[model samples]
Target: MGLNEAPLLFNFEVESSENFTFIPMSVRFNLDRFGLRITLAQWQMLPLEDRKLLARFPVDDDTEIEPNFDHALFEMLRTHANVEPEWFTPEEAPLWRRTDSVPEGVTHQAGLAGLTAPSVARWAELDPFKRYVLAKLSRKPEANHDFVPAMKEFGGGA
Candidate 1:
């Protein structure tokens, strides 16, 4: 497969130093991205140092990370971590089609109003990509406020 056709997450490094470990994360497999879920429990078993390092890794707005493990490591993580494997191959779709960029203004007052302080605080902890998605998801056809509400939902307020 070509670069675009190949799974980008396949290049992720699960381990670099012997001591660093990862928390188990459970995710549904996506054939398009070649992703599989690992439970948080399995991640907790990793060496604390490794877990700490992975924490610095960037997760996209969709809570997705790129340059993940290759097929070999996918199997290894599943086997060793005891994570069940579910395989999928994404059907061909235009990679450039944007679904989440719904202009610059969107209202998320409904979503934000229902959230707790801690939940809102945790939302702020997310990276920009996550913030972007929140803004996109909460946008309406005729939003009054700028994407501010979604930004606050993800912990970004001005």
Candidate 2:
């Protein structure tokens, strides 16, 4: 198969699929984990089908049937966008995968959004991608906040 199925997305990210304007967290998570650096301009340079292919590829443990997802992305960008893939090492120990404690940024962002932060047990219950979404959403200051929607979608909020 040339492409995998569409990876699961947070509700907020689904809107971007209409034009592929913003990168989906599913793709972003994998990019960060795999050390691939795809810029907004670089993403826009690729054809929609290539963008969709990147979005569809899975990075989970269940992805054994697929060719290496990052390699596919790199090749697509190189072939279609005519751009060399930039690389950066991602975190050796990402904070999102921690279950013992909720990150300060997550709690702070949730508090600012007026949402209850996930408790340690609740945090531990999340799949890695969900945890990854929360951590990424909360790690930075942004005018458009998705942390609340993500928290609610993830059942960390009412």
Candidate 3:
């Protein structure tokens, strides 16, 4: 099934028991990014009470979900994953570098920091995720100071 179908596939109910406190299953991280896919085997490994708690956790569209793992059961699943996540190299991932789409503030900041054309091209060659992070950081007022450091870390000249 597709990612859109993931929630539906795991949907079900469990009887509540006084012995087990059913907390919401909302851990704050994107499980998909970590390549953690909990399936029936992992679910079965968890105690019935833990299962009940997980079933109640809701998923939302917010990306700022903090990496909260207060739940012991959730931590166990992450640590002992049934499936491993496929890692990607910088070249393998998607590229989002469009010179026109890049905000002028970012370019100005880079220029002020003494980043030349070669440096800018190097920045463009960075993983799209890193580029995205730089773009986001560059848009903040008075945040341009971080731009050069980030560029240096990403293989651009200072």
Candidate 4:
């Protein structure tokens, strides 16, 4: 996600040893999931000592850092910001989507939609995430037993 969408928690400008220039860094949290994104203008801004510390862990291209690193990073950030981490139960987590983006394959499936007019209509009213789940379940190559249950759970089926 871009900076606009992410909630900015902190911004740090660290001095680089090479040219004594200050580099901009930001710590942003994504509401889509529980994660943080750290942006550094140049990799050189990271101290060799800090690099050595993180070398033991696998850092992937995706912003989702390793759990160990994540915990340490958050702890360090919390210490700097003087704030505690907010906790949320599963039930309190934000819903993934609010509208459906239905695919043509799903709309045209005779076997899937022929006998489920009411369910299909109800599916249109479900949140995008629920619709996505149902669509995915419906498109499986193998026998799909979960579609009906999912529809029922969402009040889509009789």
Ranked by TM-score, top first: 2, 1, 3, 4
Query: Could you give candidate 3's per-residue lDDT for residues 37-100 as a string of tens digits?
Result: 4544555566654444443333432324422323444565655554333333232222235533
- For each of the candidates, give the backbone clash count: 19, 0, 1, 0
Candidate 2, residue 34: CA error in Å?
0.8
Tens-place lDDT digits, model 2, residues 18-94: 56767788778778877777888888888777777677766563344554777878787888778876789778778
- List the global CA lDDT of all models: 0.37, 0.76, 0.43, 0.39
lDDT of 4 by residue, 89-132 (tens): 32232222323334443443425644343344455676554554
Question: What shift in Å separates residue 45 of candidate 1 from its native position after superposition?
Answer: 1.9
Q: What lDDT tens digits, residue by residue, belong to model 1 across residues 8-126? A: 12112233222333231111122223534445566555445434434343333222344443343355555556555455544344211234332233223433444322243344455
Report each candidate's C-alpha RMSD, comma-separated, in the order given. Answer: 11.5, 2.5, 16.3, 17.1
- CA lDDT of 76 in candidate 1? 50
> In candidate 4, where is summed lDDT lowest over 10 consecutive residues?
8-17
Please identify model 1 stretches exceeding 4 Å from their true place: 1-33, 58-128, 131-150, 153-158
- Candidate 1 TM-score over all chains jointly: 0.34
